[model samples]
Target: MARIITLTVNPAIDKSTTVAGIGPNTKLRCTQPTFDAGGGGINVSRAIKKLGGTSLCSYFSGGPSGAYLKQLLDEKDIEQSITPIKGFTRENLAVTDTSTNQQYRFGMPGPPIQEAEWQNALKQLELQLNKGDYLVASGKLPPNIPDDFYVKISRIAENKEALFILDTSGEALIKAAKSRVYMLKPNLAELGALCGVTSITDLDLKSLAQEFLENNDCQILVVSLGPKGALLVTKNEMVQVPAPVVHQKSTIGAGDSMVAGMVMSLIWGKSLVDMVRYGVACGTAATMHHGTQLCIKEDADKLYEWIKQQAPILETN
Candidate 1:
């Protein structure tokens, strides 16, 4: 089995709860909060496990909150590697309004990472990665970390001859796009940014995606389209994978679930067409749960079967 490793530079302890109503200057009663270990790569690792796969989750740890995050992952039986830091980890809150069925999230800026801390993380990741491994680096950069941090990680992946999968945004995404990346899972907005355009229409999407793969060092581009599903673009093929409609309870962790699905498909040596289809299934399945529960294997399997029956929108542009 090929070793899979996920790197989350900024991980968090997520607290989720539901309230009857949300209004200013009102004392609304909230249900008991539930906690989960969260971050882009962390959630991907969790989703992979839920789908009956294993991955090594490596992240920066500090203070009590960081310890709690590790404990949460430990309870789930997910293997992990911890890099100690001086600053405490962050916490995020998700509150769902029962009145409007809308969720409000409050995110905290993680502790400022010291120069040594960030560099140490890179060294640790380099040591853990091996040839033919999959190195997944996701989530936002913490305070004080340079925007080119992921670009450096891309170099490390290259040195190890590992496949680098990046899911991030803003300058970080743009900087890393210049490096040799095996895969990128970006939403339409992120894709537009990569193309140096403010907007993208349905007609221009295929051309732009093809242009990205042609111009950049990325091998695969998966542009997520929310409820519409995702567009998978490669050098030789381009297709739009449609998503199945489901009762949406929350949108959190959907993208991570999708990445997990696609990576697992690659591990299984599935075709790119089927990989994107399964990815769409996992993302759609994630919406069927409340809070950050993510996708269940049974739901993903059923949705994947349905998606397999649909003809993908092939683009030859």
Candidate 2:
């Protein structure tokens, strides 16, 4: 078993293609379509694999689409443990308009999970984890699942003395934060939602991040700021990682890849500052790819060096 395990409660088959242009009620000719097994944790696992690390990805799947998702993972040589549900897994579509150079995404709600099915999935996770391991719970919960699902799983990791890294939003994130997780990865918007702030300007981001760390027992907070970069906040210090300016082909899965890079660095005993640096590299790499294609190892390494060269000095007040 790998030392790191990622949990994604809701998964999907993501299909993407390009069209000349997009307009309402207009016929559009799509180019070749691409598909990938997608979910927050799954993308993290994929990014980890790209960075020459291994992690087990656990998620829920069912019916034909689920079967295809499993096959997709197999093709990527990714290790996975999927809980079989009754309904078919959902499919998400992303269409890029070449003429306008704009991308549009259509997402479908995933299949609803039953109580017994969810319990069985938890049992599977319990069987895999042990002391000193790391459990990464990412993404949203499906319908009929409790909001505190990650919280319950965090307790299990706690019982085993494993580190629990939570990447989620809304009530699920709030509930899991109450468990005093090892790390919480939230974008600026999600952080604002948690802090009741509508917009997270550069001047207010650091203070807001500190407030969350103070109020919640969270050990570390990583607030992603998109083009502005990410802020890493710990009890003792705060560091802002600046991303390199790159021509972005896609921004999807950037956060997941960033989490994977940070977690991998942590497992390797890297310093928090270096971890955030590599995280920025991973995120930048993800944007260099098209559609759902995540960061490649070479891109991550190249960007890592560039980030280290311009390392941001952290302050401790």
Candidate 3:
């Protein structure tokens, strides 16, 4: 089996709960909260585990919260490789308003990482990544972490002949897009940023994707279209896999789950079309649950079958 390795630079202890209502200046009674390991790559690893696949979850950790994050992943039976750091891990909160069934999420900025700490993380990647391995790096760069952090990781993956799959945003994402990668999962806004534009109209989406591919060393581009599903583009193929709509409880972790699904499909020796279709299934399945539960194997399996029954919308440039 090909190795799957996920790296989350800004891991968090995600706490979620439900409240009767939401208002300012009033004490609201909330239900007991649930805590889980979080961040982009970590969620991907958890989703893979949920789908009965294995991946090595790697990240920087420190302080009590970091220990708790490790404990949570352990409870889930997900393997981990952690690098010690001085800064404490961050925690995020999600509150569901039971009255309106709406979720309010509060995200915190991650602690600053020292130069040595981040460099050590890169060193660890160099040591752990093996050829043909899939290196999935996601999430934002923590405070003080360089914008080109993923770009550095891309170098290591290239030297090791590992496949680098990136899902991130902002300056870090812009910098990494300049390097070679096996795949990139960026939403519409991030794609626009990569194209040096403020927005991407659907009219020229394929053309822009083609232009990006032509200029970069990236092998695959998966642009997420939220509820409409995702567009998969490569040098030879272009496809739009429609997502199966579901009663969405929360959309948290959907993108990470999608990445996990696509990578797992590749590991299973499935075709690229199946990879994106399964990815869409997993992404949609994630919305069916609340509080970062990610996608269940059964739900994704059913959704994948449904997606296959419908023809994929194709595009040409």
Give residue 190's error in model 2 in angstroms. 0.7
Query: What TM-score would every model get versus the actual structure?
Result: 0.98, 0.97, 0.98
The pairs that clash in candidate 2 are: none
RMSD of each: 0.9, 1.2, 0.9
- Output the lDDT of residue 148, model 2: 90
Give stretches of model 2 more than 4 Å off.
none
lDDT, each prediction: 0.93, 0.88, 0.94
- lDDT head-to-head 2 vs 3, winner: 3
Taking all chains together, the TM-score of candidate 2 against the true structure is 0.97
What lDDT tens digits, residue by residue, belong to model 2 across residues 90-207? 8999998899878898888799999888899889988999888889988988888999998889888887888899899888887788786999989988998889888888788889
Q: Write the per-residue lDDT of candidate 3 for residues 34-135, one digit (tens) a residue.
A: 999999999999999999999999999999999999999999999999988998999999999999999999999988999999889898889999999999
In what order do the candidates fall by lDDT, top score first?
3, 1, 2
- Which pairs of residues collide in model 3? none
